[model samples]
Target: MADNQFSLLSKRRFAPFFATQALGAFNDNVFRNALVILIAFGVAGLSSQQINTWSNVAAGLFILPFFLFSANAGQWAEKFEKSRSIRYIKLLEIAIMCAAAIGFYFKSLPVLVGVLFLMGTQSALFGPIKYSILPQQLKPEELVGGNGLVSGGTFLMILLGTLLGGALMAHPGLGTTWVSVAVLVIAVSGYLASRHIPLAPASNPDLKLNWNPFTETVRILGFLRGNRAVLNSVLGVSWFWFFGSMFLAQLPNYTREYLGGGAQVAPLVLALFSIGIGLGSMLCEKLSGRRVEIGLVPLGAIGLTVFGLDLYFARPEAATVTGLTAMEFLRAPGSLRIVADLLLIGLFGGFYIVPLLSLIQTRAPRDRLSRIIAANNILNAVFMVTAAVLALVLFAAGLTIPQVLLVTAILNALVATYIFSLVPEFLMRFISWLLVSALYRIRVQGTDRVPDEGPAVVVCNHVSYMDALIVMGCVKRPVRFVMYHRIFKIPVMSWIFRTARCIPIAPAKEDPELMERAFAEIEAALANGELIGLFPEGALTRDGEIAAFRSGIERIIAARPVPVVPMALRGMWESMWSRRGSGVGRMRLPRRFRARVELVADEPMSPSEVTAATLEARVRGLRGDAA
Candidate 1:
């Protein structure tokens, strides 16, 4: 029923925030572009070098506020309702635009530059509220789609603003007057949209306001150190900004120097790249089945490296080209490949960034979510600025734009490998998700019964060697499986299991020490508020029938007394991984492609009320005729 991510636009909860943020982005670009154009062309009696200096100063001024006041913005968001805060920010936008209009009328660079700093401050104040409000508004399953739309909308608006603002500023009849009017109008529209946003209560109503940006910024980043996933996601996102800034900063130079194209060619390249990003962001929802699938991160990294390398090679020698329009450049030999490479890089960029943003929104502590986002903004600004500096260093070192592209591409590969290695969970989940989606069509029922957070024991009927893999893939939350030690050590699957932190256990008769260790580990995990999954059947079924439940579950639950959830796996016994014919001999057999598998879960049983026999019956009933 929910086929398209755009469907969210019709809903009140999402649409208003979406409109408000999109318009804010549009206005930001419009004002910035108009000011840059006035400096470049309309300014009276200024040297080319002085104009360039002023432009650079303006650029640095815009980014400086994100570093200076984001911590205070985050604190304000945490201390008050987000919707109210957004309205206030939008009001500030109107005031800024009013000031900008006056600056544009006077054609004063200082006035416009000051307005730019205020614009940056406005954006910084809204940053945390914009992101932190999403998780509170959308369902978990809808997060990817919501984020995709937001990303697409933001970039699309940027492209539009760039085109429109430049057009309006250079227009014979309109000039500064029209651009100023547009900004003020858009600012008012943004405020009107913000009025419709649903009320979102402060996450930490009692959070103390820390107005000192320096100390608070340090404290905010310190909060991230405790959350490895959130911290890593932040780093990943920052790297993306770095990569993007480097690529974008080189586009004009690349078009002019390498492609022998004019000013128009830069915009053409930008349209291609930004449009590619928009489409790719929307495509993420479809590829991920509307879930926040971090698997796309690795996939994006791969594309970035591959297309980036191709882009370097696609660079034709400067001698082979002459000054050409964008259309002519495209019609030229080797240009289409270059364009394709740019598009794919943008596509992969969408794949890379949308998930990381959603991951931070979903995984960060709710109370500190805004502050964490502030930290992310600060890091992103730092990385982007560093990327600009690195480009300067590279140019000084005599590296051409294409050579720099090659280096960035290689660096992307190294960084991706390092990050994924550090957190094998990302890769392991990707592998498990890939295998499950490729080999079986999973239909999960009663997913809501699984606790969204906190500790619980998931007891399921074990039907085949692939059972844990299937469960791991389908479950929304990360889980630790208790598997037989031999199965835990089985080939490539063993590596996946180890990376996933599955507990390996042996029966008391075989190894008492191992058995004791397993229980101890399970208890520790539960105490730490993690999910522990176990196959109460102890081993895979031999005759497509439910095996008698093992009493180990009782001991495990009795020690911890957490809720026990009963789950069932059906239509798996006939799969090649099952011992349907030759028992262990069937281990090497191949499964039918895309087997239809159903994983059904039932209500969680109170720990005090659950027993081996009762839990077994519950799982059997859930499995029914399929077992």
Candidate 2:
């Protein structure tokens, strides 16, 4: 396996798939852009209003197939080997591009538009396979990076294709010929790339194919809703598409009417946005420490709204100067700010989306992930259509483009708030992620020793109040920590702890009933195949030394025999939250900010071989002299 996301690009498993998808995205945009340009410029005897109507019709026709065929596409993805399906889909693209070439040669608008609908059907079929294949090919630790690369690459190719197509069509006499040749070559290249993709076996080999789109759409949606977190993540992804489509749909006009810029300026703004998305997508692996880290989702949401609203304020009025060229527009007053706003919006949009896609892949059932993704595609198409309709309605009511953007930004905040409210986990993780990342630079090791699934108890040393947060941030799986009741009740942190479902425990001497209840909960959680985290030392260390392991671990294990994983948190004793500065009873600010900390895990021990003393010794060895 590759150590980093970019390194995966050099490997066989990922590179071929990436190339195939990137080529497909490029070809789709190439065809679409060429068709639009041909309609707007090449075709004669058409008024501007008619061109506008045709453009709108083009968009609608392309989106229609997703609504009609996504359910069946999902079924096909689940029922057949993915690589084979991809090859067939690529072949279908070849046939479509052939039709496109014929349409281009004859300069037939209806034939070109029909080819666009077929292209959409091809994309709709590819959508489910595109995402669902990732989890099969990559490890959990690689999902974030993998998703980041895919999202970034997709957008980058779209930009390149748009530029190429538009440039080709701008040629006076040979424009159609150039476009037809380009589409054919790109489609053939995509098919060739698809041939290199390694075999990815079908997830549900025996899944009965559902031929009816209407009935299967409902069934797939039910599959999506089976897991609340996965469903919301899908909703979050669809909302991102909605938000993005509206912004993209308005950009040309926004550039023309508001910035008083020529056609060149629109693409410039688009290039900046596209590059920002790529940069932000590449940054997700580092920011998340290469985990799914949906904590970044809320942070992303905040950025999207802030920059979105700022864009409106940055340019509320139309420019007095008309028809400024791209370079001249960039030189105008407040232009850089507007550019910055769009760039940051794209950057945050990348942050907001990558994790949601990763979450859906990780959380959705293996057999039905493609179906859930299909449902997501359906909703995305619906939301995109809704965005277009809403824009028309707002324009009819006489709102300027800037004002409409302002409305979209406000609605984004409201929608994000609603989604986060339903799943407080996103917000909770964000808070912990923010605090821990601010206070410490965490280095996690041997997390792969923790079981990816099934029940286990993880025992670590008690070092500081931030131990759970540090461990939570480092470990890939969610840990239900058993904490001292007092520590669990600490103001703002309490809400996070409660929301994370941390087990609040009291010492037997102080509250026997609470201790017993905590024990019962641990047992139940173990039976339900959830990981339980425990500080076997039972309290924060009075000194920066390993305390003797308490017998409570033994009691818990005796009730439910499960594997015990030993973990250690090091370099935390000197932190602000620890007892080092003041005394065992209080904490003070650290001498150094952003202290370096480490969480190390040893291999799991069977119940028969585990003992409190042995576990403590193992953790102490893992911690070593770090404290």
Candidate 3:
């Protein structure tokens, strides 16, 4: 069961949701695939160019609904029971499918495209409800795994759906009658799947629902701003859509003209692309060990960069390959490289997006989660629209399809660099990443064994700047470390540590002015009920021995009186940073990973129970074998 993907499919709570989602994704592609093929191949004897124009138009219509309707859809998700909403949305899909059947029967492009817009509208309504319901039904540990399944399943369905739709449309027997039959079957199956979903009650039962888009957009942003992590996750989600939309909207053209396979080959390339994303998503749970690891963010960015670059180089030079079916293309050596390159693009996409969504789910406040999702949908729509426009402009500028792909890949690298540069925690995680790799790798236990939603004054032995970074690495909640004023001034690290808002402390004897300011800042931060972290040992151990904890820790705890979590800096004593003979030495800078290190948080102590001796002894005991 653990090894099998279908094991998740068999569970009732998951299966029906999976089926409903799959059906939705399938219907979306079926219509889209049919439309694009109709254009690309001259279905119904229409001119190929006319079909292509209409196909792009159909794409625009589907995405247009998100701009006009996402706000209302988000409200609906929050204002009503999600299961019931799913039922109604499913029924709506059935209606749209009937409309599609009508258009298919008549071979009317206008009616078919209208149905595409209707289908998009239906999906827009489902978007907010779809994500908002998941956190409610899933356990915390299961959230990452659940989201992985959802993303993997959704992308896989897209590939399957694309294949199904193309197959149906291309069939010699797929006249109006056959098309109508397929539509009805898909609709009914989707409705039946929706029927089996377990009821998920509305999260914000008492919330006042707003209907106006302008006011509601403002409301949603305001709601989103309430959680910093959620806000960043939304931006990350929007960026991904911007990134992916650029590639996906271009592939069909690239497949036909650049790969020289022409229209029939478009869906094949897309399926390869979607499958890569599904594979990457499916691997996430195992990679994360079932935790929502933000560290994967950089990994995804790196993968996106490397694979996207290779994909550019993988495109065959324009002459040798004229046209071929999927099999012939696969057998061709160059095509296989292109295929592998594309699969990895999608794989990286999976790595890029899944955790971001999971982050939003886990970090967003419960009450406003739906609204934030709605905002995310709107931004996704915006980015996608921008991508479409950019593709049109770039293609119109007389660049070939392959050139457009190369340009986007380059832009992706530049964009990733900017984001990581802006938020160095992404890079800071890189340092912590290397440390974890080289070390025996201690597991963080009972970290929720700390506090979920309150101020904590954490006391520990100071070892190095890496000490603060390591602790920040292990803890989920952001901590404000009281770093030594001079260490905080280290060039590259200075910016990152300061941005993390680490309080810079100076020893009184060396700099009384800076020391006083540091105390004032510490009090100010603690007075606001923020977590204030500082090491009492004052400096790294000179000979792998704990220094006497300073009195500043005692003063801070006495003044703030928050729960003080005694922490230990184990084996970091032997890390390259701590091995310096002098109290401060140039010998140990943060290496890829130091020889070995661990930051362990012991049980919390009330202010009354905390004393210098008690804190030292507790840190010593927790350090255990390292001590």
Find the candidate with the highest lDDT and give its number: 2
In model 1, where do residues sit more than 4 Å from their true spots? 444-449, 574-576, 580-591, 624-627
Give the CA lDDT, 0 to 100, for residue 32 in model 3: 78
Looking at model 1, the pairs that clash are none
Native-to-model Cα distance after best TM-score fit, residue 429 in candidate 3, in Å: 2.9
lDDT of 1 at 170: 81
lDDT of 2 by residue, 1-627 (tens): 567899989877788999999999999998899998989889989899999888988899999999999999999999999999999999999999999999999999889999999999999999999999999888777888999999999999999999999999999899999999999999999999889888999999999987999999999988876678888998999999999999998998899989998978988988888888887887899899887788999988999899999999999998788788988998999999999999999999999999899888877878988999999999999999999999999999999999999999999999999999999989999999899888888877888788867899998988888898877766766789999999999999999999889999999899999999999999999999889999988888878999999999899889999999999988988876777756533445455579988888999999987888899889999999998
TM-score of each: 0.95, 0.96, 0.83
**Candidate 1 lDDT score at position 588:** 49
TM-score of predicted structure 2: 0.96
lDDT of candidate model 2 versus the reference:
0.91
User: lDDT per residue, candidate 1, 1-627, as tens digits?
Assistant: 355788889998899999999999999998888998899898889899999899889989999999999999999988899999999999999999999999988998999999999999999999999899999998776788999999988988988899889989889856999999999999999999999999999999999887789999999999999989889999999999999889988887788888878767878888888988898898988777666678788888899999999999888455356678878888888889988998999999999999899889877889999999999999999998999899889989998999998889999999999999988878887787676667777766775588877899998988788889877766767789999999999998999999889999998899999999999999999999999999988888878899899899999988899998999998987775777776456354556678888888899999988999999899989999985
Q: Which residue window of length 10 is worst by lDDT in model 1?
A: 583-592
**What would the per-residue lDDT of candidate 3 be over residues 186-222, giving only the tens digit for each residue?**
8789899889899888888887877687788777767
